[model samples]
Target: MERKTLITSTRNLAQLFATLEVKEASPQYSLDLAWPNSHNISVSIKRDDLLHPIISGNKWRKLKYSLAQILGSRTLHIVSFGGGFSNHLHALGFCCHRLNIRFTAIVRGDYSANPSPMLHDLQMWQTDIQYVNKITYQQRESPAYLTLLHQQYPNALIIPEGGSNKLALQGVAEIISELDQHYDYIIAPVASGGTLAGLIKATAHSATHILGIAALKGQGYLEEHVQALLPQTYQHWGICHDYHFGGYAKRSNELVDFCNDFYHQTRIEIEPIYSGKLMYAVKDLINRNYFNKGSRLLILHTGGLQGSRAIGQRASIL
Candidate 1:
């Protein structure tokens, strides 16, 4: 897909967002995993990672409508929060750069001295970086702090950490329409629960069941987070918090090995932070006979390959 030229005109910006072009279709490929249980289950992956080069996977979906709102309004600056290796900030910075808008990233922890590959990419995209202590970072969502931020940067649109908002949910809901065939299960990685919330909302009345593998430790609060985004009660979805490996952004030798093996087998790159853990959970569940025989499963490959750079020795463990 051709990149849209940057424009300052409201009409042109509206048109650009209205007709934003992403890769028409991301190819889905069948995956073969050695399951411990004797059951007839088929697995396939929706390669949302191929949606775009930078704004890939669920990040693009989350940002689609958020950017539209920013451009449609008089907001000239976009402010958001993330960690050192945040794909959310990386994608948001790239989008802001392409759209000719200013992006300010409030980074968690004092990572200004040592930058990761994701942070470097954000810098390359001309994102204004601000380092904050953990204490201040925790106040990111406080009403007083948000009010202060608005006062500091007038006309700036503050996107929640991970871009998990109502607009983001709307964009993620569109992912369901991209699937050509129906499956019994739809599984995705859950961080802040925006993508899973969107999927649950889209499949609330369908026969398909939505499973969210939490990517963070103690993510039971994700149920409430997802419920807040959805308009009505959704009972077709459940979350599994056992696959985080260690915790958010934490990796292990086993995870690295799995990621390497998965890439070698499927020719698809997966970062340990999200997609790797998701595949790990899917395989573990399959082994434990979690799915009925003859069940078809669809896994969402929400991209974060850029984060693989920070894996250090673990990336070479395989």
Candidate 2:
């Protein structure tokens, strides 16, 4: 009976993933910047955002292998941590609901009075939402708390915050295989470092350089996280730390204006959190003549459009 249930659960999980329709390769297009550039630098964006409406961009890549492993192991429950406007939790909750897998989102703060759009979705999906204060949330990786969580939900597969793990790197690395052409620099927003790490791992052997635009202020620690995920040392990748604006999820008026202007000019929507900062950094780099003359750049648009809705913007623009 247990084996039969496991087979059924795996089959359902497989079918749910199939329904996501994550393409083998997402669309890529050039960005015609309105500003002048003396250097012959060209920029293009890989629209990973179009991977799905909900399970979009790098979130889908990061979770792909992890969910497969969990389901293959017959684990029917998932526990993970995230902030109020987390794309990770939002995507996870939707997938778990589709697979009939129990999900618990250990949210980092009390939002009972005013829940974010993501929190509302979690409620709609019937996710077990547990609000914890910042201090307790900091102990998420502590062995003591993990042990306690194991005792509480023995059957649940506990994923780390941002789903940055070995399996996630594997999924992110696959992005390289789908690309039809080579780029001088392949760029993506760096938060927990998994997505950038995956790019680094993927192109470690190639001449293509992986550039991560840091969306937050953790310069030193973010490098450490990426290094830790790497199997060995590789110097083909680097990060740009100056474009974070204020900090994670904290955007300045300048950043917001840039995003709006970018959307208006290119008809490509970007939020201030990740893609906006990345595009901003590219613009700055080009203006400052950072890239070599005639160099080509490819930016990965890791989608978190739902976050735009959280800030009361049109979800389409995020």
Candidate 3:
């Protein structure tokens, strides 16, 4: 089953809405391990602490449960799809390097003459990069899409565009197990919707509200993605509606300045993509009294700070 019990502090406030409390089962989904096979090499950060360069948050979360299914018998060639400035790609590049695995990336959009600095750095990591038209790129989540990809590159361990899948979900859901079970809501950005969907699926109907902030503009389709993973019982979710500061990868100097100010205040680092939006909404909701004053809030840090390295490259160049 997907791990549980751990709750980030932002979740604490969400529990106050629990008309009733309950325990739910979010069993393990798929698995595909790709990491150090060196037996007896124990590390200090029991939680996927691959060298800091290899990464910290989403890398471990996306890999943990996926590794179990691989059975650890091969020199995995890790491959995934992403955009030019993708943090998932960055994490995959670094993680694959540390795990002694080959890495490949299928990125969407035309290649810029000077791509985001993050994309530039991944090249130095020796991750092979391929570009595809956006139409085919958007089809990445489909099983058929993956099958077609395998026909072309049959020997790679495939991760979806965002490292998004039931397996990656299982990995992230495991983070909940590390926290105290006293949260009212858990919020994350709605990207491919896998992370938010997995969270709600794992939490089930535990009375804890799962609120996903849509960084993508006009993301009503995320509701469709959530429905794909959850039962009708999850009809009572509290996914928030207004946080996109334009659209994915779109931002303003206001947000940039806000992030700097927010970091000074909370000592918490939230990337403009996910946690930053959550932080903005969380504070707003608290002020409007949607959240109880004394309630606790657990804002998940889905970790995409790497995208910030190339701030000058975003399209929302306001």
TM-score of 2: 0.93
Each prediction's TM-score versus the true structure: 0.91, 0.93, 0.75
Q: Candidate 3 has what TM-score?
A: 0.75
Candidate 3 global Cα RMSD: 13.1
lDDT of 3 by residue, 1-318 (tens): 223223422242233112112112122111121212312121111112222433445554665444333324353777788888887788777656555567888889867577777678778888888888989898887889889888877776787767667777776676567654556666667777777766777777476777787877755677887676554557546567687888887766776666666666544455677656766665566556675444445666566666766664223322
RMSD (Å) of each candidate, 1 decimal: 4.3, 3.4, 13.1
Write model 2 residue lDDT over 138-199, tens digit each, in one string.
99989999999999999799998999988899889888998878899999999998999899
lDDT to native, each model: 0.84, 0.88, 0.61
Model 2: pairs clashing at backbone N, Cα or C within 3 Å: none
Q: Give stretches of model 3 more than 4 Å off.
A: 1-54, 142-144, 231-233, 312-318
**Candidate 2: regions farther than 4 A off:** 1-16, 313-318
Q: What tens-digit string does per-residue lDDT give for candidate 1 at 169-245?
A: 88888888888889899999999788998999888779999999999886658888888888998789999999887
